[model samples]
Target chain A: MSDHVVSRRRLLRTGLGTIAASTVAGCKVLDGLSAPDHRLRHFMERANDLTMAMQRGVLDRDALAQEFAPVDIRQPQRPNGVTDPQDADYVAHRNARFANYRLEVGGLVHRPLSLSLADLRQMPTRRQITRHDCVEGWSCIAEWAGVPLWHVLDRAMVHTSARYVLFHCFDTIERSLSGAIRYYETIDLVDARHPQTLLAWGMNGAPLPVPNGAPLRVRVERQLGYKMAKYVRAIELVDDFSGIGRGRGGYWEDRGYEWYAGI
Target chain B: MSRNTPPGPLVRRHTRVTRVTHWIWALSLFFLLLTGLQIFNAHPVLYWGDQSGFGFDNTVLRIGAVDDRGVVELFGWRAGGMGVLGYSGGAVRAFPPWATIPSGTDLATGRVIHFFFAWVFVVTLLVWAVGALLSGHLVRDLVMDRHHWRGLARDVRDHVRGRFRHAARYGPLQRLSYGLVLFVLFPMMILTGLAMSPGVNAALPWLSEGLGGRQSARTLHFVLAAGLLGFFVVHMVMVVLAGPLNEMRAIVTGWYRADAQEAGDV
Candidate 1:
């Protein structure tokens, strides 16, 4: 027989085998419209169930990742992609060793003020040992000392209308759709008030290094390392984060990172 | 004996569009598996590194430069300028000689291809989904009855014994596997894929946390893709065993004739 003919004959036999299997497989227990599409749907349905369950588990209030010991700190954190802030203003800030650095706290706040580094140093401070979990499959712990962000917000006297605290940093990993140079991150009021959260100025009991967010940075211990905005130059208290980049919460959010980095 | 033949002529089994889509999806999945394995050589699960036994190392050439136009361009350039590797998208390269899959190396090209093809795969799946849902094929063909659940043990016994002759149309195990792949694994892939996207991650911070951050998502993506690959292998093996032509036709044309009297006849 010709190859085509042989193949066709084989097809008939295999088809028969399959049909017998299908019948004994108990598909007739259902109604009887066995088709390839039906099989595909079955797969899709399974995947959907998994996705939704994961979503709920992650977002659910009870689920929490385990915390580690304070002594587990990695000596030197090899900064992931972006190290230094590329913006001219940030470069100028670094040039002066951030002596003249002033963090602008405005936007929906009752008192808009640009507090200098010296002024920030005089505020009430808190220190805590925390870990930095990189999405790159590495983890590092460090002792950080900085003023509580709540203290800064208290001094700024944020408006009651404020719902989101936006951190405007000085580094640019890439560019947002709006062509902004600096990277930004934000947090809701709950995380904003978490005692572990602070505007960290020192790491490992030393003044923050330049590669690290020198001068000042936000330390949100409850979340992943990325949420801890480095080289924080401004804190904008906004009522809504929807007007932000791509209507997502953070700079990286537009690029596909989850808005909640609470690992 | 003639009076025992109560049924009419066997009917045509599969629709044209259905057959085409099935073959296309199957072939695409095959290509995807091969490329995926090669790409994953960067991070081989067991004994994958420079000192490993498999001893294959693939180089990823990432190209990024500030062009004369003052615009920074990113694209994959050939490694050693050997020009053996072809560039597909922005700032990516795939060099052969992969060991186990290298971990912590750039799979940006793999990622891009994976993402691009994912959309195609998803679109195809969606088409199949919509067709099934509209035609009510799924309700009749897929939904397992109590008897099917009861027969699960027997099916397992049959499958293990290489007696899967009855699994042609839609067996309970097959249905269950398909269900999990479609609903559980596919969505996991999509969500994890989306979770890894910096753009998406930045927008949906919750996803990063949910999927254990961007890197974690990448890790999960690889693991899940591996699972799919396993499924594909077994599927192909079954096709081979069940008689390739018959299996292909059944999936394509959706017709098969099985006689009780001619059980063991050639």
Candidate 2:
């Protein structure tokens, strides 16, 4: 028999055996479709990159997320992720009404500074009724008032080498024997500088509620809810994110969510 | 007509582009539907208007479970069907494991696969449309004229009676159905999908707003999927009724062997 020749009996046996094995495993057989090193998964990730690039290229970088009229802000913003994080630092800050709280700004910046809540409130501000799109497919519209992130970045004198802005939050979304992991998120400079991107201090004309990130949160309006890190404690500018959580740029991203949540 | 007559000489039916894109669409739709259900399992409620939360009241559909009961509420009407929707095989999930890709609550994986095939769907549609137009395949085969509909009543009457006019050219009814699906439903699905995207909404705010709301657009997407599923079922029945082997050969090999005497009219 030639090296390339296949016997009919052998082919039938192999095909039947494979079918029987698949039947035995049942649904778990599809687990390999999402396995880390699966070839199909690589294609999917590559397609994600293509989608990201296409969106980035096609959409005007400055185009603002849809802002609704006051009448449209019918409901209070729904709180997601960790509400009332029990971190001691956060509790103390809450106890004092965030009076002594300071949002630390550092990393790849010319000026590193820690500013009080009052400092953020005093910056040039914008109030817009915007829809909060959740990754789970529900949406909520609410009014958010805050200083554009660019203003804070300019004040900190972000370095020219910086490519991404990371938001370090006080809330821990996952806890395990290894230790609690605080939620964090990252956005590119384009989104960081977008007009609607806010380091929000207020919601629906009221002081930010503890249930809704309290004193402050970063809102990347063009992205999904997870991209907007709540309980934002510090901001860091970075050129590379590979050293961050699982190197995927956000807490949820580390667990296989898309880093670019725009879509 | 004689019962024992052989099929006539094979004739080229589906163009290479048509055959290739058709299979690609079949594969993409298969993956997209399964993964899409998985994503829906994340939040299985459908509402109207721009928002959904504690404040929104227009709960059009809600698939959920309690203890051992699975509940599926649609437009205020409710039903219980375990092992299908809501409760499935000892767990609480909107859609059963067998119906979803990864067959679990892996929204992350579901999202990855859904979006991956979604792009494939979009790209293939563009290629198929542009090629069909350039090759005149759209005009010569899929498009219908007044003359094609002249025998419409007879065609439907025959179809309902298990009789078929398995011709080389598409019947007026077939063209109508395909037209509705390819031109209307497909575009609606793509647009509805985009309307739900916050990024696309930024660039085309009117897309979601004009659809009444983002949530409404989501509902429409689901409804349209059901429509596509209906079409697939009817399409399969027609394929089987019209002669599976000939239909399969037409698609797979670009040649169909059918009785020339029967198919000669069209």
Alpha carbon lDDT of each predicted model: 0.59, 0.86
State each candidate's chain A TM-score: 0.73, 0.89
Which stretches in model 1 have alpha-carbon errors above 4 Å?
A1-58, A62-65, A86-92, A113-143, A172-180, A221-226, A241-250, A254-263, B1-224, B244-266
Give the CAPRI class of candidate 2: medium
Docking class of 1: incorrect
Top candidate, metric lDDT: 2
Q: Compose the digit string of candidate 1's lDDT tens values, residues B1-266.
A: 11222323334445554566676676556435544544444333221111112223222222222221112112223223233222222322333322111112333223333333555677777887788778665665567789779978887887776665432246677767777776688788778766643334333657756775444565677678778878888887876764565566567667644334333322
TM-score between predicted and true chain B, model 2: 0.94
Pull out the clashing pairs in model 2: none
DockQ of each: 0.05, 0.67
lDDT of 1 by residue, A1-263 (tens): 68987887777777768866754443223222112134532342244333334443554333332333454453555455467777888889888888889899999988998988888778888876644655433444467788888888888898999999999888876764757556788987767876667888887778888788887888765565677788898999999888876566776554444455542
DockQ of 2: 0.67
Q: Specify the highest-DockQ model's number.
A: 2
CA shift of B236, model 1, Å: 1.9
